[model samples]
Target: MTRRIVEILKKGQPEETITIQGWVRTKREQKGFAFIEVNDGSSMSGLQAILNADLPDYETILKNLNTGASVEVEGILAPSPGKGQRIELQASSVKVYGDADPNTYPLQKKRHSFEFLRTIAHLRSRTNTLGAVMRVRNACATAIHKFFQDKGFIWVHTPIITANDCEGAGELFTVTNLDLNNTPKKEDKSAIDFEQDFFGRRAYLTVSGQLQAEVMAMAFQNVYTFGPTFRAENSNTSRHLAEFWMVEPEMAFCDIVGDRDLAEEFLKYIFKYVLETCPEDMEFFNKRIDNSVLATADNIINNEFERISYTEAIDLLVKSNKKFEFPVEWGLDLQSEHERYLAEELFKKPVIVTDYPVGIKAFYMRLNDDNKTVAAMDVLAPKIGEIIGGSQREERLDVLETRMKDLDIPPEELWWYLDLRRYGTVPHAGFGLGFERVVQFMTGMANIRDVIPFPRAPLSAEF
Candidate 1:
């Protein structure tokens, strides 16, 4: 049986015969023997194997065992003389499955810029940085499931194709099956007739699954949707992605304060879980990627997130006398710069800003008694501004309908959603956490594109 490098590295005893399969990360040839480092994507550190001159097909195998080559080695584990690792493999037999031409391989034995690595997305995971990122990403995902499952939250799968624009942003990616070469037109011949489309009406890749999650939450009491969401906005920034994953958890009979508490606990749980599960990868990120990675994780895990109302945050920002690009006001939405100032500069920790102006927040958010603001909240992390956005949903049918009418959203289109309030509506709350943004925050990766495996952005969807 082939042993995973992680398991072997953690518990394998010396002088045990085993076989390992992985891609060669580095190779150093000598007159009597050769040394090769192999990684199987199981851990941050690869297994270092020493290939002797008397191994089968030694000369030819040595030539083929370049970086990026696939190989299987039968070896006996022993104490390493190297300083970095505790164990090494002494190979008795080696088989080279495939060879990577050093002349043409994009990933050499040196550092490459993130931009260049993105171009070779198919091969970039072999590099140390990307490899560590992928492992951490996996750990984060597993921790998400574990966190929710431990609390008896049902894992709900929401639809990818939705008819209503949940965010009301008008940045939806339309889903249709009409041939544009011979399209169906309206009577005026100006617009394509969506009546003849596949779904018999306009459909789109879901921007947010909170609505569907709300439906399930009403039924199950607690539920979450972790799935891909899309937006058609042409944002070419380090923080935006056309396609990404979201974690949204909805709870029935919960209020704004309960929602805020859940978000804080959820974030702390994720940070602690990832730190414990992927210490090596996290340490690599701290030393090489960003020096603040470890410290930030420690802060999140140990500290209680600071909380303030949106009005109070604005007051603080104003009192600090910091000149922001976008002016801070009561009715205006908070920009990234303002959020960073509140979380990173003023608070020096994660800040939960609540009770945003109703005019700026979603129509579904529960309106406060003040008649001007809604029970909406945003969890702003130190580096990644707004990490999670959530609100206590409006459960009163009359108020929800009025809010929808005020926002000019068609109430008839969301008949099923309205039905939930019409029948057995209970106060419910949830938040949407961007999966990539959390990974980027945890690893201190400079670019959001680097955190996701295949990033879809404006004019850039190569893989």
Candidate 2:
């Protein structure tokens, strides 16, 4: 059986014969023997194989074992006299499945920029940085499932295509099957008739699964939705993406306080899990990518997050004596700079700000007794402004209806959602965490595009 490079590096002893199948990372021709580094994508480091000149077809195999070549080596393990790794492979036979021309391959020995690596997304995974990132990403995903499942939260799969714009931002990608060359129009011709489209009405790629997750939460009591979400926003910043993954957990009989507790615990759990599971990778990120990577993780795992009200947060910002680019006002939303200052400078840790103004929040947030603010909360980390946003849902039928009507959200379209309030409604709450954002935050990767494998952005969807 073929042994993974990670296993061999960790536990393989001398004189144990094994075969490793992977792409060659680098090759060095010595006086008597040639050394080639092999990686199978199982870990951050690769295994070094020593090929003697006396072996049959040694010259041909050495010639074929370029940096990007695919090969299988059956060798006996031996303790390396080298400085970095523990063991090295003494190969008896080397078979080259495919050869990569050294002149043509883009990934050479030297360091390449992340911007250039993104152009060749198909092959960038072989790099040390990208490889480490993917490993940490996988660890985070596993940790999420394990955390939720251990807490008895059901993993709910919500629909990808939905008619309701949950955010009410009007940024939605329409889904249709009608041909544009000859479209079906109404008698007035002001708009195309969506009645002839697929599903017999206008449809869109879902911007969020929160509403559907709420539906499932009503039945299951505690449910979480982890799936892809779409957005049609024309943003070209380091933060926005046309397609991304979201983790939303909804619970019945829960209020804003319960929601805040769960969000804090969830983040702490994920960070701790990643640190424990991928220590080497996490260390690499700390030493190489960003110096504060490990410190941030330690801050999250050790310290209790500071909690304050949104009104209080605004007041602190105003008295901070710092000149911010955006105005620090009561009604305006906090920008990234403001959030980073609050977490990085003021508290020096994570902060949970609650009770936001109702105008800035969604219509479903529970209205406070003051009628000017809602029972909403945002968990702001040191680097990232708002990591998680949630609110206690409006359970009162009369209040929800009035809020919907005030916002011009037609009541007929969400009749099913309204039905939940009409029958057996309880105070519920949930929050959404961007999967890529968490990975980027953990890995200290600057751009959000580097965390996701295939990033769909504005007019850029190449492999």
Point out the worst 10-residue segment of candidate 1 by lDDT.
161-170
Give the per-residue lDDT digits (tens) of candidate 1, residues 1-463: 5889999999988989999999999998888998999999999889999999998889999989999999999989999997888999999999889999988978899999999999999999999999999989998999899999999999999999988865674499999889979999999999999999999998999999999899999999999999999999999888889999999999999999999999999999989999998999999999999999999999998898999999998898889898899998888898999998888887788999999999998889998999999999999998888899999999999999999999888988888999999999899999999999999999999999999889999889888
Q: Cα lDDT for residue 267, model 2?
A: 91
TM-score of each prediction? 0.98, 0.98
Please give the TM-score that candidate 2 achieves against the real structure. Answer: 0.98
Error of 1 at 105 (Å): 1.1
* Model 2 residue 326 lDDT score: 92
Model 1 backbone overlap count: 0
Model 1 TM-score (2 dp): 0.98
Candidate 2 local distance difference test against the native: 0.91
Q: Tell me the lDDT of candidate 1.
A: 0.92
